[model samples]
Target: MLNSNLLRKLDMQDLMVFIAVYQQSSVTGVSEALFVSQSTVSYCLKKLRTSFEDDLFINTRTGMRPTHKACTMYAHVLKILESINLCHAGPATFDPTRQAVTFNICAPEYFEHLILPRLLKNFDFADLPVIVNMHKLETDIPADELRDGSLDLVICFGPNFHRSHPDFKSQVLVEDDLVCVFDKRATPLEPRFSLQAFVERRHVFPTPWTSTTNMVDGWLARQAYKRQIVARANSYSAALKMITGTDFILTLPRRIQKLLAKDTIFNHCEAPNGLPGFTLNMQWSQNSDPDSANTWLRDQVLKACAEQGLS
Candidate 1:
């Protein structure tokens, strides 16, 4: 039933070129994106057409549009490319001290306060050429970005974040409870902050760029209680600064409290009971899990957490 000659006519490189052309929609765009020449793209497209007996892509004023047959074959083509990649993936052996590779990670700004610093310190043990790129954690970080090799790892919080993406494998890095922060000069905490006082005080809440809701506000809403938010800021550092000269209070993760405690201007207490805590987790694409380099990175993170006594 199979045509041996037809099978022989197809090349893996031609399939890859076809995929690039289909996704980019322009010969020039494919060339630029894939680091190939336009002539090469044209030659491949010509071969593809001759084999399939159809013009896979048509040039128009807007861009290169895929023919109906080409549109139907797009998903299959992607799978083929993916299978080829998996087939060619070598064993997961990497030397962090010698391998010249860059690792990209994404996490929230709050992580920059404690976790990130410790993680970076762990990397100092390796004397090899290594580059670490950090990206801001977005609320809607696309699963495809991780799958496509754009990000190596993600450090984030939640009970539900990334639950929808089955391709992401996550491990708990730390569990942190909420704490109430106040200026030592303005708010006097003889023992601990009372629930009544916690709700009555003017709050300086840090609102992340991706969402309007703050962590403290969400917990309060669940209890049918709402604090008087005097102001909202985008950075936790800014919120901490605001409470320094005023009676406003901030409720954030306990790790942050410890990080800022040495400043002496701010003091923190346990957040009132009933408020929810969060789990910080490290996630990586399952496709990258087999790579020895990614395994090394994961181990380093866990080591950092252990050094901080979070494990």
Candidate 2:
């Protein structure tokens, strides 16, 4: 039971008014930013209130305060407004030789280390303005940033994260099996590792921030097995450094092992339990600017994965 006519009446201008007011928390601030009279901004607010059938903002001693309803509505409204802007702006004349853009990615540093070097070598972003910001991937609320437009894309371990968000699209870029890495010189036994042998050895595991553990831990729980984690670290790099020249073994992605093959200190060890391989996905929100630039960026990521023999 939705009123199509009522929804159609709501436009981008009204959304802009709402966003400006929400950010600045005052009609005067919005007026200053939009270069309009205070009355004009107030008028737009009134229209939005009527459209939403709620008092979206309240006059306070300090400035203006948003109602709980307004706070919740702002996120969706902002996303919709951004999508509309992208659609109208159309594709940019993306000249990598001179164009400038900032791309934000949410992923682990290990992922960046494996893919960024070769990826950057192919693109000439010297004259063109470019900025790449890497964000740590969170286990909880995977696609929240992408939906809110804070993140352009997410490189996550699996498809489970995007199943609920139908507006997002994903492509599997690489499949990686889990492998144990140990120093070749420190390894005492044969090349093959048994489940008993794995459990008997001291292991290095990336510690979860809270009670919630990682996928490997979950897999271990299913088998009714747990490792005696002698060393814990927040990142794979830290874990790798900790295990080098030590007797501790670390579970790592095969792609990472392949990338680090040149390093004489590390060698792959067999996992007898046959841990499940994970798929690395390249995901973007449907709300993203469907411009040529966005398309080119996605293509570049895919090409880089293929070049690294990860595809």
Superposing every Cα of model 1 onto the true structure, what RMSD results?
14.0
Q: Against the true structure, candidate 1 has what lDDT? A: 0.79
Per the 3 Å backbone cut-off, how many clashing residue pairs does candidate 2 have?
Answer: 0
Per-model TM values vs. the true structure? 0.67, 0.64
Q: Candidate 1: which pairs clash?
A: none
* Candidate 2: regions farther than 4 A off: 1-93, 125-127, 159-164, 207-211, 261-263
TM-score (C-alpha) between model 1 and the true structure? 0.67
lDDT of 2 by residue, 7-73 (tens): 6676667788899999999888899898889888888888888878889999999888999999999
RMSD of each: 14.0, 13.8
Model 1, C-alpha of 292: deviation from truth (Å) = 1.6
**Index of the highest-lDDT prediction:** 1
Which residue pairs come into collision in candidate 2? none
